[model samples]
Target: MKINKFLLGAFALSVGFASCSNEEPIKGDNGGATDGEKYVTVRINSVGDIGSRAATDNDDFEGPAEGSSEGNVTKENIRFYFFTADGMPFVMSQTGVNGTVNTNMVKPDALNVSNTNGDEKTSLEAVLVLGAPEKYVGNRPAIMFCVANATDEAAFEQFAKKRLDAIPDIEVNTPGEWSKFRMTSSTYKEGEGEGAKVIYYTDISDNVKDTKDAAMANPANIYLERLAAKMRVKGLGEYTVMEKNEDGTLATAQYKIRDENGTTITALKVNLLGWEPYMTANSCYAVKNIDKTWTNTSLFNGWNNADLHRCYWALAPGIVSPNNNTIPLYDNNKFKYGNYDGNKPTENIVYTYENTSYQPASVTDRSTKATAILVKAVVKLEGSDEGIDMVEWGSDYFTLEYFKAIVVEAYNADKDVTNQATAKDVVLKKNTGADARSNTWYATVKGDDFKRFSNISWWQNGITSYFVNVEHLGSKYGVVRNHIYDYTFNNVVGLGVPGDDPVNPQDPKPSYLAARVHVLNWHVVSNSTILQ
Candidate 1:
């Protein structure tokens, strides 16, 4: 068996380029072409540590050689590699006209080249050119220089800038005396130039430490660090940074969104991906992870604005009437029956009805005639089939017959009952149609009936003409739910209780006696005169 030797130490410039003839080239079975391609070569001659004291001493610190220490003090050389829009690689080579090779040579196609100046060194220049001119166009190839030293870091940066500016079509814009330069090409727009962006790594003393701290402290810095860490882990070379900016506050930063591919996105529409409560009071809150590695099986789940609202609501205390004035008596146990006095009413009212078991014989007699008459008139105008039960008069339980009797009695009491009666005309027409439930009932009742209901002193005094008609069927029959009622008659004349429930059984044909209670005094009108 024969062994093939691999050429490992050959320099990129050593690749031999064979002269081409006008004859057809031969092709190999393994797809190797007989023709050869030419490539550009760049060279850099670094003068070695010019700004260091070691350069002045002839002592060889590392070796016994007479000039070893002097050589060690020479400037350091750097090279960069670039590819055309098409896939082609080139190495930059460095060559000095007056001195020996002290620094590392530049790569073949590197556009930006830099070297430090020694104390003894008066003038230093590097020669670089593309190896293959046929492969490129006008001003397609260029070079940049960055000079730096352990001391006076800004000097080398300035020198580099001056050198870069000397090159044709290269312009530097230093806006605020900032040490950075914005290099623009005369041939192209702001960011479209060949060497559009160039950064000088002048200070390396604490570069690593500073970058590490930034990565840990700043989100944007962390993002860069993560990218760098990924590059290292994946062994991916030639990674470039496009842009970075500070986040809203130093605490939390937002990066101009990116796509999966490592391309710098220029134009994008950023709609807040997560909930922002500070932006809107009604806004909900949510949690988001940056890694994007979360799966359905992960312990972390996505939340929305609704979830935030739930959290706030949970922490918030129950709505306590600002002054016991805004809340209805129905909610206040002390005022279980009805107490609008300033002093805190006694809790004794809470168990009064429970122990008595004695229901008010007539919810509305001559004594409470004004209140009863007003309620009946309102119910008639409301066209509420589920009549007011004893509950409306402050009873807890309802018998089917009793509920029906209350409705019959209220209907009979209406002296001027008319066939054209409808709650819409009487109650709803007067108020704004902003609330759906209220507007619906108002639109349904007759105008005449609404007027009559709105005119009754007691009903007008206690109940608002504008009331919402809610359906109480099934499980919802006995459950009191809130409704939006507006009163236009007087500022004080508002619906006492905003919640309502069906007095009769919703199903089973009323197997047991039931009564609908239109609980009164639940919500009071703000500016009503009668209630005040």
Candidate 2:
């Protein structure tokens, strides 16, 4: 980001001044003086682009090999929404020579925003220059920034400038509302994810008092949380990651998954996954393993963002603990919920890219907790029949690929044991839909609908990958039970009966896809019986 010494000097002179000599300046400010001497030179240190995070979507806490997107963020159409700490939107009143605004807004020099720097080592760019906000003039001030990618930059820009209230309702293609104007909190708790130490506004400005430090404790650092969960391909054999201190800790497995067509799938894109707006204060936060991870993160005392998350991620929705689905106010070791082993939750719960942060969006009741990732698939495997070739769930097939989702991680969290069910060439029957005491998509086959068997949840708590040979999955497994659930919505079943205009969330009756997979007989099932 080229900072024109000339422009910076002129900008500093014009803002807050009653008059200016900006006869040749970009803005109307020819040149002027200001009353207050507070100006924040915010550099865009975008944390967590897809490439940097791809490697860490694993058992390892620090991100992947420094430059693998793992297919998270995109290299093109990068955008960052700049705003006040209080959520007030800011427009681009100025852009230097290299600055240009697509439908989406851009900072003068965005480091990793577009991956222009070539790798995770972000370029020396991406910043927002601001006049001292009047609200925080006397009080300590801070800024908020969010990163997102959009196909249509103009559409994103129009959306980004609106008040948070109106942002969700507007419909724009490519960048869905959830992925679009739906702004996520960039203010991550320190030490949970990877990034530089956040800079306080006081530290950047002329303020001598560290009022913000006293009020918020941690400095204001903005991290772009990964919106998409990662799904990597691997064989049936479990590949455990040893501690770095342990011999061969650096060793890791490389998983490659292919579609029915045999095309190598480097990474799979995900959508319609569960996302809840910032949990309202005092709402319940249960079993988001990161919370448990936090005890060790900050020693269970304060918010430590980077240290808390094993893999900085968006929480996948579902109840993994089969024993208890109840969400508590919080779990800081007291009144804390335990895992299936009846042992209290701990930070060392073993990390996986697929998270178990199933905090209820509205802890008030069951009616409003409907945010889920919808999924439906149709594919013809090498020699599989029609039943095995196509699989469809959710309200409609007409929904775009953006809505089709995959369940990455689902486990029985309540107890140490999971249900053991077997599918004999299962083309699982869609037993019922939307209405029933329990709508189970039973893996029972009537005709040739069944193909080879596969488990929904991998034993190692990662994504379920394909293996051409059942022998590859192993020889000591039994039933692979894929737990299918149905929903009861507000007078609508299956995503609002198809024709609803702008068929999206925020509709009168929305549908969600939050799943939990419980497998039985890990200690008993033979690989021959399980894979066959």
Q: Which TM-score value belongs to model 1?
A: 0.15
Native-to-model Cα distance after best TM-score fit, residue 185 in candidate 2, in Å? 5.9
Give the TM-scores of the predictions, in the order they appear. 0.15, 0.32
Candidate 1 C-alpha error for residue 523, in Å? 41
lDDT by residue for model 1 over 338-453, one digit each (tens)?
A: 21121322211110000011112232111110111111111111223332221122222222234234333444456365543322222323223343222112211332332222
lDDT of 2 by residue, 1-532 (tens): 1221111111110112111122433243212222222333333322332222121123112222122322133323345444444534544334221234332234332232222335334332232223334432233333333444443545446656654334423432212222221212233233334543322111222321223222122223333332222221111111221112234222221223323334232321211111111111111111112232333334322222343221222123333332112222122232221122213212111111122333323211132222221112111222332212122233222111111112111211211455422232223443333431121233333243222222111111111111111010122111111101111111101111111011122222222212222211100111111100
- What does the lDDT read for residue 196 in candidate 2? 34
Number of the predicted model whose TM-score against the real structure is largest: 2
